[model samples]
Target: MLLQETAGSDETLSLMQLDLDDFKPVNDTLGHPAGDKLLQFAARRIQDCLTSDDRAYRLAGDEFTVISRGSGHPAKAHRLAEALVAAFKKPFTIDGIAVFVGTSIGISTAPPDGTNPEQLMKASDLALYAAKQDGRGRAKAFDAAMLELLEQRELLRRSLRMALDQQQFFVEYQPLAEGSRIVGFEALLRWHHPLLGKIPPAAFIPMAEADGMMPDIGAWVLEQACREAMKWPENYIVAVNVSAAEFLTSGLTDRISQTLDLVGLPPERLELEITESVLLERTVNNIDTLNTLNVLGIRISLDDFGTEYSSLSYLKTFPFDTIKIDKYFITDLETDPKSQTIVRCVVNLAHGLDMQVTAEGVETPAQAEWLHSVGCDRLQGYLVSRPLPVEAIGEFIDRAETSVSHALV
Candidate 1:
């Protein structure tokens, strides 16, 4: 069986050259079944790209390899792989469900690279790994450094598997205010790794998504934060961060609803904060999931508004009730006159849409004054108070209450 795959040609040696070079994302968002169908479709499309003699194989999870023989222009082979990837660039309509999948590919040749199936595939995989590292939905030829990086990435992926389950993570709630009154808390996920003091979300969130652990990790975050908030004053609300992955994951909306029910927390007390990137050109299911959440009476805040290229078109489409001006604008409003103007414009625009605007990262008195003067409805920052643990925050609020009562007396 293996021998037939390794004996093809200089350009297309059986089992030696890697065809269907792209690595498909096996997102936990899409769930296992959709992932399975996409993987099969990838294998079929790759096989169809080559000769009848070629065969495709699944390495694991979302990885696949195809064996084909040919001496065509390395460019020609890439062009064929490009065609397959292009087909995938369009959203996949599977079982009446329209979704999207992206992949990266790598290629290799036989005899010189390897006559044996294992040796040939190793070279091709090294090249493919390089392609994916460069970014998904692209292709690359074999290289050595990329092989080493792949081994390192494998080690990183393994350590992250039990990260959330092991309790190595926690959330810090930043305060948001309507003038002097606290209105909500933005729940920010923090990973306090034992060996590494802190790992940036940028480093691990994408890694978790790649390793297929996002749904579990993300759901854990929702449950923990909701339970924590349920202990707070009834008027206080918690904003749980939502990633685009939630839409792809089948049971996420249901899981979240179940979680809220478990804690007996009102949906209005919980807010799901999502960035504009998640809503831009999203699949139908993803959009539907957001709509479902909106109907549940939970507040949805478009966090970090104006950071991306998503225009007013997307903004007008959703039922988001709040839009948080990104910290960058707030941090500069004190000195950068332009920033002050931008904040004013955004506040006006948000009010025009009937959406409340909250200014984030309000570090100093001057910035706060500017935001307030410009009609900003809310303020959140270090000046207000950095994020504290649940117990710490309770104590902090108690101290503030005593201070106010003393003044009243």
Candidate 2:
């Protein structure tokens, strides 16, 4: 309508796409009613910042679009976008609670960026995506480079989808040790592309999750880890990391039970590691899923503990068998007194709850010594050993056993 009305004028049309940052956490923390109220308040704030000639639309959940005719240039559109962002700098007062969120805006102008609604919206959407990628709460104008990055990410997504079927994925076991005695191995996933050679899990794991491939990949990991554990000492347990996507989408409990049964691996000998993100949903269904998995004698470890928001709440909410102090705290333990205190406190906290603690990323013997002194039940990282392929695990274990024997003698 703005384009039609201003067809004959020397006017420029600018479309701005806006996305609210971390909006789901509000709904998850406060009830959906509060989230709804916050969204309404946020929309009014955006609408209030616009002129009579400009209009705003709630295109979708926590996303809005501003259409401005006669905006003159990209600079003018940017100023309007900045004004909308500034409006969100304050918290939304919902039910007497001050809740916070920020906005990311993507601007696309007509004639230069696009001419029609479809083209303009796409450009603006891509710009919005770029703004979010650039850490949110900012404005990014439509640019050619953003499109290239998006294309590259799409290529990665495609490659990751076929990694499993192509037999390009494998699992490596990192020995989790306690004073030279190998208690178990933490299963890590590795991928080697025919053309790319080796792709780090850090680079592709999120892409796999985004593409909804984690369930299949996670199942394969569980089955493979179980089968491999059958080769280890009877008392040793194998730990496999599970993502939130896999936990929620897959029949994880049934799959674990069945995989253990098929491999003839005892349930007590398998551990499933979950990150704090898995507990964010907090729905009854997710809680039930965790409970069911726990009932099956599968040990559940809260992986990457002390890394995310509300670590203690997760411990209280779910029945976790172990907690892994994040590597950052371990890195700071030597130089920072606060890190030492935090580590000691976590060790005590876990032990108080009858849960074991694992100190991750212990590089120096000093760090290991301090952790062992503080009663950390397990140690994992380079100081212990890097993740090794299945063929190499036996040798690693044998070497560690010999070293322990020498020390004892």
Candidate 3:
């Protein structure tokens, strides 16, 4: 089950929660005996948590909780959570089979926190989710601010729906280049949200996809980007991101062709950037779509390479023109050995496919130099320029042109 909730009324109770990760992998990789032992061991640890009236429950596989009568003291619960997480740091041995793992925990309180077991648990679960979102293996306490942020997200989600109806979203283009020469530009969608002000794409894009509203948003971005590209200088390409949710609903080839015909933009000047998650489900179907897009002369870019599941395997199977090494790997490549190794591996792999490689997040001259030396074919980041509106693109493009022309002279 994704989650479980139990409701109770007319009770003032404080609930503390803790969740374990990597708990299932032991059984999945070893045997059920190991899993049982792990669960039993966890139950014992939780039992130790009890003092007099306090009681503990092993709710299900990999989930445990301790509850007692009183108000939720997040400080006390937070310390207990640390002790529990620290317990897992050492390897656990079941019948001489040593296993190691890590976990992330979320904390929540009761009564004023929630009226029932379900609501209390739900609030704690949200806190737990936030812990995992911050990169896992740590615990975080529930706060009013947390709920406020979620409420803001919900409000923004509603705003996103209204913005679409009001035509409040628009496209902004950020140019990508092969060393000072513009090869293409990415079509970024901006929401001039009425209530939330200018909402970042990172804020609402995933929420839309999760709700299956991405098809509408994606269509809007594609149409706006394509139409705007028609106004740019000849040979200036437009790259648009295809949401996985939308990709499942719209045929990639058909979407491009129809959008181009509707906007009077050439297909050759269009590129589609797709994240790895897009290929998770419906592999064969997505492959068919990718191949069709290739045949239609639209460039396909692998967005956020090396950051998701099935990187090398997907590259071997999919039709793509470019591989964009994620900014996370490039931002500190010069200082991070892991980042350098990741970038080097991706560059080699993309080159082996005869595909061009673009290192994103080149925010320093040293980073740009490193990428150039390592055979990265393109670069995109603030080190070059920030994303600009079409009205501002002309001046930026002119300045860039003059700089290059002087270098050539």
Candidate 4:
């Protein structure tokens, strides 16, 4: 009705949609009562930023919408969004406990972006999604480009649902080497869309996770990888990456154990790799899950280590068998003194914890040699071999072993 009233006049109105970032962890950790209190405090902060001409509404959980009416709407909307984001920078004290959260905002202007509520809301929602995708805690204005991207994403999502059934998905194995000898292979998921050609995991994996498809997809990958590993040398382990959703899913350990038994692969021959996100919740259930997997004799590795803020603390908490240094630090090892120092420190830290360290993206022999000098337990990257299909693994392993023997000679 407000939008309808504004449409008849010469007034320009802007709608801003705001979402709280990292809000779930607070709710999960502190409980719903604290989350409600935090939301109230957040609302007060947002209200303090608004003028008499603007009104705020709580759209849903951790989501707020503001309607602004004025001459300079875009500027006003931008300023309002910026203010809300800045306001969240300060911690909200709940029960004397300081809790921090950030906000991402999307802005859509009336008379330009849309005139009706539905169109305007859709526009703002799309903009908000873009804000989150571009590393949240920022604001984005709706544009035609966002609409196109949305269409592409929707198409991909629908296609992804049918990908497994259509046999468009496969697993690739990248070799993990200790010095010149290959000790294991990391299982990487690959998708080949019939119409879109090859889709990168970075592009589709998150989408699948969000759509609740990872558990099913992850199960298939585990079975397929284990089946293939059965053909490899008994000593060569196959490492499979596990998403946070899959890691936290109930009966994950049982599913994995079933896959191994079904494929006739020993539990010790498999390694499950997970990132720090899985440990962010620090739930007792998560710890219990890890403990259960450990009891099953499956090697659990911390993948892409040293990327998150609480990496050191996670190392202290979790019983990770191996820590894989992120590729970002290893990429500059040859040129940057800081990278060298950080990598060496991480290697030492992992060793001190009785956990091995694997350097990712070791693309050059110099990096490999330096990593080995620091007692890095493993190396994996393009220098050894690119991720190969199941058909190519046998030949590649044969050639790799032959090359290692010649080097030793």
Q: What is the C-alpha lDDT of each candidate?
A: 0.72, 0.85, 0.76, 0.89
Stretches of candidate 3 exceeding 4 Å from the true structure: 1-76, 83-103, 132-135, 250-252, 404-409
* RMSD each, Å: 8.6, 3.4, 5.3, 2.9
Q: Which residue ranges in model 2 land beyond 4 Å of their true spot?
A: 1-10, 47-54, 68-72, 76-90, 337-341, 401-409
Q: What shift in Å separates residue 157 of candidate 2 from its native position after superposition?
A: 2.7
* Model 3 whole-model lDDT (C-alpha atoms): 0.76
Model 4 alpha-carbon drift over 4 Å, by segment = 1-8, 29-41, 86-100, 309-313, 335-338, 402-409
Displacement of residue 139 (Cα, Å) in model 2 is 3.5
Q: Write the residue-wise lDDT of candidate 3 on 1-409 in tens digits.
A: 1122223444333355666666755665456888899878777766665666455666777877666453346556666677767876777778887777556777766545775657778787778778877877787777778888788778887777778889888887777878668766898888897665888887788788888788878888898888777877887888999887888895556766888888888778888999887887667898999998888888899998877554477888998899998899987887998888878878888898899998887777778878887889888887677788879877777687655333322
Worst 10 residues of 4 by lDDT: 400-409
Per-residue CA lDDT of candidate 2, range 1-409, in tens? 6655544455687889999987988888787998899889998898789887688888888888888876467778989999888888888888998877999999998878876777788899999988887779899999978789888778878888888999999999988887768788999999998887888887799888888899899989999999999998998999999998898884778878888889999999988998877877856877898899888888999988887654566778798999999999999788899999999999999999999999888877778878888899888888777789989988877687766434322
Which candidate wins on TM-score?
4
CA shift at 376, candidate 1, in angstroms? 1.1
Q: Mind sharing the TM-score for model 4?
A: 0.89
Tens digit per residue, CA lDDT, model 1, 82-191: 66567667766667776666667777656656666676678877877666657667767665666677776676667678677789888888776677677667888888
Best by lDDT: 4
RMSD of 3: 5.3
Local lDDT at 97 for model 2: 86
lDDT per residue as tens, model 4, 1-409: 5766777567899999999998987897679999999999999999999999899999899999999987787988998889888989999999999998999999999878987888899999999999999999999999989999999999999999999999999999999988669998999999999999999999999999999999999999999999889899999999999999888888998999888888899999999999978886646888888888889999999998877544476777777899999999999899999999999998998899999988888787778778878899988988887889889988888899776434322
Would you give me the overall lDDT of model 1?
0.72
Tell me the deviation in Å of residue 242 in model 1: 0.5
